[model samples]
Target: MGKQIQLQDAAYILKAGWKLFSRRTSLETLQKDKQYREFIRHNEAAGRNNVSDEGKRVYAVATDEGVLFFSDSGKGMKTRNSYLQHLADSFFNFSKGVETLKLYEMEIPSRQVMELADNSIDKLAKSDLRNAGTQLRKSEFSFTKEKMAGKEMLEGAVCTDKYDLRPDYNNFDRLTKEFNLGISPRNYDVASLLYISENGYAGHVVADYFHPFSYEYEFRDLAEKLDDSIKARQSAPMSLHDFGYAALQMEAKVMARDILQSEFHITDGEFRLSGKANRTSQRTKTPEKCLFQQSKEPEPEKSGCQAAKHVSSVVPQKKEKKQLII
Candidate 1:
């Protein structure tokens, strides 16, 4: 215990915090300290037993000010003094390499996302419904008229209101209790019908913007419930806007996977990229193109966002007629 106390005292003297290395004082000062003498005696005794008198190992110490180094080879002080410079050069090269190799997910076309989601819903809707009702009732999502055809269809996910158990009929109120939609666009509810077909998926991040009494209780609650489903590509302490972006990214990835296997030869994940679909119909200013090509009809404008739009590539196309081009 006495020896341990002496070693600890020596260590405390050497430990650096937000200060520089042992530059403020001289080695002679440390040698005069009682604990330092005891530590040196212990160290020398251990070294002699190991039959090692020469020094070649590099020892480094990190402090808030910077890193310091020492060599046991008893070499000149010049080499040890330049260790910080060498370390900085190596770190700079390492940082450059890391920046070059960083990977990023390509942005999906905002316009065509709606069409992709619709097609995805058409194929996976039945399967999704079965899984929800049978195995995952708590987080089960459904395909509603608005969800399948709404403008925000691709940017948001909606869960059923039946599981709310609360007597309140208000959607916002239910969200605060223990409910959450998979994801939604910024400044909009996951279940809201307004701004369903609006363009733009951009949003800004907010700090602790959804605490219980932050008037965004529902948003906070949903974020909490979705902790498992949401995966962020950025750093920790994500905001609501980050969640929205993550949700959109997740949906796009799923749709892209499905597209790879489908007949739509729009994108090959290389040259072709997704973009927004044009609102105006080139073929016949009709409401929207039907899912089935069998019987085409003039869709009612009331069902603005109820139909899946024909997706197109980022390249400009002739204004002759509405054609699916990638």
Candidate 2:
């Protein structure tokens, strides 16, 4: 049986995990720091307003042991729902280790979480800081308000029947079969359904009353099929896109293992992978090899002083820590 932990504990675990995995120093800390806030405001004034969401945010962590831990920033249900669906799709398609998804709505505000992250990042060495900027640019996946506004909504036929009574068993069957779980789809409670349209656009159906149901129940598209071949025991050559996605998944799994071992101190058996785990630890350790290749020739390496000067010019220097009035 999976162990249950308190939301506060989950938050702490997530904070530690983020500090380890994310190139961003700390979301909450940077947001609260007066100087950083001013810097962001200045950037916004200059029409570069791609700042992180100030509203309640949600953080999700999934493991191979079929356990998922979620910590909500408390207020943004609509935004949270969208993000949850995205996460669900990511786990279902890319991450095969995950079995069960769980949520723990946090009591603390999102700002506090960012502050915690800021404090953690402040302790890092200058070398780590230098690497952080580059790593962040490589892995950052942002969801700007404009992008969210342009997101395609589900316009398929809406089902008046309750989720349990719904006639279409295609999606549910596919989900169960993919996971290889013993339970029926009726017993499998999901937060949402992510579907790929016949035309190839991706959309989600929240598991609510009057949810949209697509007739094209096939979840795995051509790209996904190509990606899955990379995960098979007998690996095949992958396209650049497929290889990059696979590398990212591998990196995330390594980070997840590290987080679980360090924070939870659980045995390997407790957090073991569900499928035949890929043995690519060496590749993951060398990020240069894991990163996608660029068509253009790489820029020459800069000297230490020149690199520092460039970094200073871009990132605002941190001032003395002061409490931010939220």
Candidate 3:
């Protein structure tokens, strides 16, 4: 079996696939294309429409290059939905084979994040803190029960609201007050938002301007639950926003699979590259091993019979027909 691709590498592959596919097509073209329109029509007939009351639509097209998906809400509220479009733009840029820093790789200027946390804490009235503490204690009881049952203790396990421990706002405030004491900005890592779709396909994006909560040791489980909640809303009769997000998640999986299949055979979620695919990639990169390259040394002449044998070995010969005995 081929070595399993790390999630980071998989993200790159998916990004490249989307860029290539998007270059070959656009959202407008896809909306007008017969195949995509037909797909939407079929879905509508099946009582799963992608159109929203606001005239926004989310759709996908299957092209030879790969599947291209789009969440198009025309020109009016473009600014409001620009975040979604920015993700597509980022995918295209990342696929340009340039050295672009990914979200997690970028050094975040944590001053803004710290300030934001501090301001939020300062705005919380004493009554608000008491209410928040009451909520956390209520949530903690259920979370503790789930933890005792060996469910919510894992690092990255998805837990519902009933099973998740609400962030202790009071603790968060205490930590913020002591932030300058020993906590360096470097102490925090950017949290990644992981999503598992309704179809059981998983994808993740690194948070751009956010870090883990000051009081939280790890935020993976929280991010996962947030993702799960978002995905849970992406169902039949979904809003335009939800439909678009769902389409993007589904498209990512499709593009990833397409890329993997070109280089590797997938079986039961395992990937294995065939010998021919591996050799072809290697030969293309190594000039001396290229099939089109000619040998530098002259070949020795062969006898006519030997030449004939060589030709027979390389080329297929017609089979002789046997005479039928009546």
**TM-scores of all models?**
0.14, 0.19, 0.15
What's the CA error at residue 80 for candidate 1, in Å?
Answer: 5.1
Following a full C-alpha superposition, what root-mean-square deviation does model 2 have from the true structure? 25.3
Candidate 1 global TM-score: 0.14
Reference-based lDDT, each prediction: 0.27, 0.29, 0.26
Q: Pick the candidate with the highest TM-score.
A: 2
TM-score of 2: 0.19
Per-residue lDDT of model 3, residues 161-260, tens digit only? 1100011112112223322112222222111101111122222222223333232223344445546646655453344445344444454335434533
Candidate 3 or 1, higher lDDT? 1
- Cα distance off (Å), candidate 1, residue 116: 65
Best by lDDT: 2
- Between candidates 1 and 2, which one is better according to TM-score? 2
Sliding window of 10 residues with minimal summed lDDT for model 2: 305-314
lDDT of 1 by residue, 7-26 (tens): 44445465523122344333
By TM-score rank, best first, the candidates go: 2, 3, 1
Query: What are the RMSD figures for all models against the true structure?
Result: 30.6, 25.3, 32.4
| Candidate 1 positional error at 158, Å | 54
